[model samples]
Target: MAENPVKIEKKKKKKGLSYLWIFLIGVPIGVILAVLDVDMGFLDVYSLSDFVAIFILFYVGVFLTINLHELGHLLFGKLLGYQFLMFRAGIFSIQKENGKLRFSIIKNVGYGGLCAMIPDEDATMKEYAVYSLGGIIMNLLTGGLFLYLSAFMEPGSIWKMAAILTGGASILLGIVNGFPFFSMNQPTDGMMFFSILRNSPMAERFYESSLLTKKLSSGIRPRDLDLLKDFENIGDMHDLTKAFYLYFQEMDKGNRDSAEEYLLDVEKNLHKVPPYSLPAYYYELLFFALLSGNLEKAKVYHEKAGKILMKDQDINGLRVKAYYAYIMEKDAEKARTLAQKGLAMRDHYPFKGQALYEEELLKELLQKIETERQGQ
Candidate 1:
């Protein structure tokens, strides 16, 4: 088993202190106002009684919103040559390794699934564009459905109110996820990108892909197909294979600057991409830093890798960080500190649950560092 990646699980703070306050915060205020003949008191009681209606509205809104968004991502991704791994919601239960994609569903009342697309790292911008679009399309469709449903629902009744809330939610979900934020050039935005190219160089590439994809295909021969033996890794199966292949080319050509520049772009798209494939793109930067014999750059890359690994709370990442501290940073003391921390962390690793490999490496690295320090 691999080590878990989460670093610290912070305790959740109590909301409004306690559940007993649920009544104090709600009932008393209503009683005081009702005694005063205030309509607010009656409305509060009425709303509380309508919890079932509100709950249903919220649930349907969240589910349909997330589901439609996910479908939007899937459809666009597929259209752009990305292989779909899973459609589960909320935090992406879909897992992929090498070329195999697995789907898993996770659910809870009033919570929507976090649909994910774990495509190959080598997938082109086109595939990414579609994957992003899939979510937007889903949201748009849901919003439209809700809008349509509102017509049949009575004007101010519970069903009508639910329809209005859900429809509005769907529209907002589609629009928000479509907008580019953080690093991800959201699927909806990508659709917009496809629409209004402006005068950027990316526009030309888009035009080429749009025109070429219509007629261009590898048309692999039987012999060529034999070379591509892994049906699972086939282009149609996972786009990361292509992304990986291109990453290598970018690395081989020593496009270190270009590689670093592209790395951020990929990270933003990482949300739509898989976790495993993400590091491969980062590896391109790691390779660049290593090849240049720039210890500082290497150290930076190692720390970046550690952060990624830390998300899984894997002890191995700590071990890797330790090795970087010792060898690259020439800080044996800090290395020792990190080593012990990582070893302790291994106790809870999800995979293997042991730091045998990292421990061995740490020992070897510590010895070498000590030897070098002693020689000085």
Candidate 2:
């Protein structure tokens, strides 16, 4: 089916409200700053070099703050008996694959940094809370320390300026991340912490999802995993994690109708899906659209996800591109080459189950392409 007009209008209205919310937040802060007559003397720069140095220092501070926040999550997660699956700073990532650490550069999709850790099978809410709050605590402590040390340094000096910038960045990071808000559709540390404290269904779903991720990372296929057996209890079928797990489970079990239903539901709420996962989501929609002979809808999805499909190095991204090449563009050789590239990365991809699935899909595409060519 084509995209729903009413759903599109609702999505537009939601986006408008998001912008309105930002404006509302900014207006109060601006009014307060103006009313307080905030001093602007510190920003005075006599030379271009000075301006450049200040800019560089500011970015350095931001970089350091982001890393520290992620590091905080790592440390706390480890303390809570959670195992690290991946750590990402900007577009660079270190992932655990087959019990080995592998470093790679990835396409950045809005996230500044992330620390992905899976809790133990018997993990409790207290542990989850601590793990969630770890980053905020680190940020607050470091921010305070930097600000204090800066006060001891000579005003306007490079060292003092650097300290001030870093300290300010750290404090802002703490405040922003500690507040319950969504950053690019992913919950903040503070959000997660509070949710866990409240013992919300979302928190439980998140915990279950983490366990599911751990299993996937351990080379277990979705069909073999029992972590999501109670997925219906999540109370929100539209929840991205729940929908994704259900889709994977049904797909792995060869229930195409059930899988497509989940994907279509996800399509209706694409705004809730994280940017990093958009390519995969769109890929699934596009793949199913093609299989169901909905060429127009398939083309629309392909176009919508074109940028990511062309540039994304992930196995799923490659698989979609290959599928589109053969099915839509009718470029058999291009499809085979793209599929082969995805197959080559299967061993090193972070999620073993996903990698294996992509490998199988690619192989299937390759076989289809060869059969079609032979018939021609």
Candidate 3:
């Protein structure tokens, strides 16, 4: 598929720190006043120790608030017949592995998380609204309940302070995340829900694209897949998704030249994709270059991808490294070692289901290398 030059939507420069952090920080100060027996009318008598106590409790409130928000997403999504892909709270994530959830940690500097749910075939505006509203509703109700309960506690008590702090934090979370707004160039849950409610075209595209991605990740072949047909008002992520599927389809049908051409087109428009998606793009480019016998180009892409893969090592990258070692460098020992490592890790590979063809290619290469060694 050939892509024509299209005008990119220029994102407006966001001009403020996110409210999430402000709420997370500010709620603790209110709780400290209650704890110090210093009424809000006159707060001139609080000690430094009270401030330190508030700081410590603030983090605890933040942690619990984040977890409650994400849990709302997970439980509500599941209730709506959405398949659970993963649950992330802050830097920690739990992903499905061999029919079980496995915990893993990653570096996420921001104070946010997500519950990735696979869209159902019958998904519509109702599901979208419900799923999006889950987290906010959780925050509001939990915060409200805590605040109400705190009213029953005696003044200057530890329980009163804790309840007030937690309630304030949860309310902050609800207010900040519940309202529709963009943060760091990404849409918030409320924004996404509002789009669906308003019948925006982009909302439908986002929904379809998410479903397609989940289907592909679950090992559905490209021949059975159908998505990304819309061209008008398509965003960069949608374009990347289409390119990925089309390139894989071409490769699966043994059309190496067409796959290479399509990949080159994707490379030209790579700036459309976000930074986190670059590793996959480079990996695909390297794979295609190797198949096309363009060793030098393959090496360049390999180096580019290696920098990103250093943070989150992958089986595909390891397999590519093995192929490069054997084919380009002619280092049989190094190739064999890397290939063995890739093959040994059966459950660790994230995209193994979707990359059946790639896995087959790696196995074939390993077998061929062994045959050559035997011939020697």
Candidate 4:
């Protein structure tokens, strides 16, 4: 696997200390309150039921605040005239369609929520910076407002406790997301903001990837995109996007060997990819493996790929399953049925750039199958 472009920066104590600090300080304060027999009123927890209630409340509080943090990004981004591409809260996604947002649910395999927006081609760094920092600003403001409200109330009052907990949740959410941290394939907001501030080439490349992804999702084929530059190793998820583009572009042109070669390159470097994105490539790898007559490897890839696939929701996922059914299970009729369904769904498929190319490949395969049956 190719090494990650950005070194896992040594975890500086300051980088993630906000979350630790909040909990560290918050826990002790809670313990002291209990030991001192402080009658905090509605906030006082004396039984197992109260503890469970508190747990559930915190869970809901965190969920809402986290989503609100993402909403903050969307609200400010839209205000700045940036195109809202996608808003995701856990497994649910709100996609922009026909100039309106549409919500869809998917398997919850990815971490955290996201509100992704696209800037104008001529947008400035300052604009990007403001948009990037939007979530943290909202988090701080929300948390600060509630914190201030709670300060005026009696400690044990329900409103005071609710406000305090919600505010703390919001502040903690801001700190965790705002501080630099690395997920398997993505960076925290603080990391992304700082990376762009430093003019990291990876950020620009990732932005380009996002633009390409948006275009592709909107039904534009990769081959149809007019580009001044070709995809190269600028690092980050952009490499995966480029690989997908080039792989399908070559496949559509009947260059199976070249496509397989590209797929192999992706396989070798998958460690550089994020965990959530790894499954998509695995699906592609499964397809390519089957195409190249490597049934064993194809089976392995398919097993791993299936874990993250949503059959009814993902048109390309159906295509992957179709190939597996035919090539491995020897179920030509089932495969043909799925292939037809996939072809019908092509224009509406997310990642329509690859969808179009894969559709062509499926047609070619069906024809080949027919020819083989005729010889029999």
Indicate whether candidate 3 or candidate 4 has the larger TM-score.
4
lDDT of 4 by residue, 60-103 (tens): 76677888898888988888877766788888878764345668
Alpha-carbon runs more than 4 Å astray in model 4: 1-49, 76-87, 91-107, 116-130, 148-154, 157-159, 194-198, 215-220, 223-241, 307-314, 350-352, 372-376
Best by lDDT: 2
- What TM value does model 4 have? 0.73
Supply the TM-score for candidate 2.
Answer: 0.73
> Stretches of candidate 3 above 4 Å error?
1-39, 109-111, 120-125, 152-154, 157-162, 217-219, 227-235, 254-353
Q: After superposition, how far is residue 132 of candidate 2 from its true place, in Å?
A: 1.5
Model 2 lDDT tens row, 10-95? 57867996897678657866897799999877667335676678678878787888888989999998888787777989888887
User: lDDT rank, highest first?
Assistant: 2, 4, 3, 1
Candidate 3 per-residue lDDT over residues 42-104, each given as its tens digit: 333445776667667867777878788888888888888777767777678786654467687
Tens-digit lDDT track of model 1 for 75-183: 6766655544345565345644223454444333123544434344355444545555666677777788888988988655667667766876777666655554322
- Model 4: lDDT to the true structure: 0.71
Task: Identify the candidate with maximal TM-score.
Answer: 2
Stronger candidate by lDDT (2 vs 3) = 2
lDDT of 2: 0.77
Pairs that collide in candidate 3 are none
Worst 10 residues of 1 by lDDT: 220-229
Name the lDDT value of residue 100 in candidate 2: 70
